[model samples]
Target: MQPSDSQLTGVPQTVIIDPNTGLPQNVVIIQQPSSGPKIIGILIIIFGAITVLSEVISLGNTISFGGLFLVLSAVNVIVGVGYIAGGYMIQA
Candidate 1:
């Protein structure tokens, strides 16, 4: 029988031989997660909630300034979310 084209490489079909040791070696790579962004996001969310609550308490009788509180709460929430997202994105 004629040797197949792949066999022409002179390497074994089921094994790889390392050039330095003439032995087979297995290597594994692992990746770690970043935790910064997630933590920041969580903190922002919590802080935003607190700020909104406080604004509500301070406006108990006045309904006219509701918009102000709404805006402030929205900004705080957004910032918190951004921090969390950033921390996670920067992790190695």
Candidate 2:
């Protein structure tokens, strides 16, 4: 009996031998690199900061005009903080 020529190619076979057990083990590991999530997190943080700053400016204008909208400004600030926290959490 003779082994097929394909068996002599030395290519990494799907069934790998386990050094400890001397038996075939079916396990495959692959590594991939991605940047989408990091970019999204950074963008979220930047937009959040911009939203917070714009809200602050609007709040100042409202105050100067004697318009009562303090609650709205506070809500905006809170939302901005939440966005920043979410972005940082995603990055981590």
Candidate 3:
């Protein structure tokens, strides 16, 4: 005879018992998520955006590449933010 899957889904049928009080004991380890990767990735993206924007602004009317720089800067910001968000989902 075999137990049904529903029977195994709930509380454990067998548990380790303490000798004195006969209490059920836990056997599994719990883990916590970390957030360091998300923080670092977000910061890198922010710096990249700042770098791109500063160059475009500093170039002023002296060059015709400011528009190009602005577009690339926008891309950097978007990608950086995306990485940060993805990191959080990974932790979840």
Candidate 4:
């Protein structure tokens, strides 16, 4: 799944306004949805692991079934490794 390109929503902070002057006072804006990256990274890692596992299982079938699976497994393993690396990068 992919994250949507949308504005970051933040926790609403209370503001104080003086009656004499009408302007926001002590408005603190908190940015970054702290858990977003971690959650996405975890999901990516899990998917990568699942892909690697399934392809590795298919590796066994190559001896008996043979052919296309061999090439497919090899390609999938590389893609899985790339996914894992990307996940770690995002987490970092």
Model 2 lDDT tens row, 1-92: 67887676557758768986777875565868577788888989998999899987787676766644676777888999999988888776
lDDT of 3 by residue, 1-92 (tens): 87887675556577679886666874565778567766766665566556556655665553456667767666665665665565556444
In model 4, pairs of residues that clash are: none
Cα TM-score of candidate 2? 0.64
Clash count in backbone of candidate 4? 0
Supply the global lDDT for candidate 1: 0.61
lDDT of 1 by residue, 1-92 (tens): 88887766566678787786766885455868666666666665566566656555755543555777667756755665665455455442
lDDT of 4 by residue, 10-80 (tens): 68988878665676665466997788898899889989999999887766676577687677778889999
Lowest lDDT 10-residue stretch of candidate 3: 83-92
Model 1, position 16: C-alpha lDDT score: 80
Model 2 lDDT at residue 92: 64
Question: Candidate 3's C-alpha lDDT?
Answer: 0.61
Which regions in candidate 1 have their CA more than 4 angstroms from the true location?
1-28, 64-92
lDDT of each: 0.61, 0.80, 0.61, 0.82
Residue 5 displacement (Å), model 1:
9.1
Worst 10 residues of 4 by lDDT: 19-28
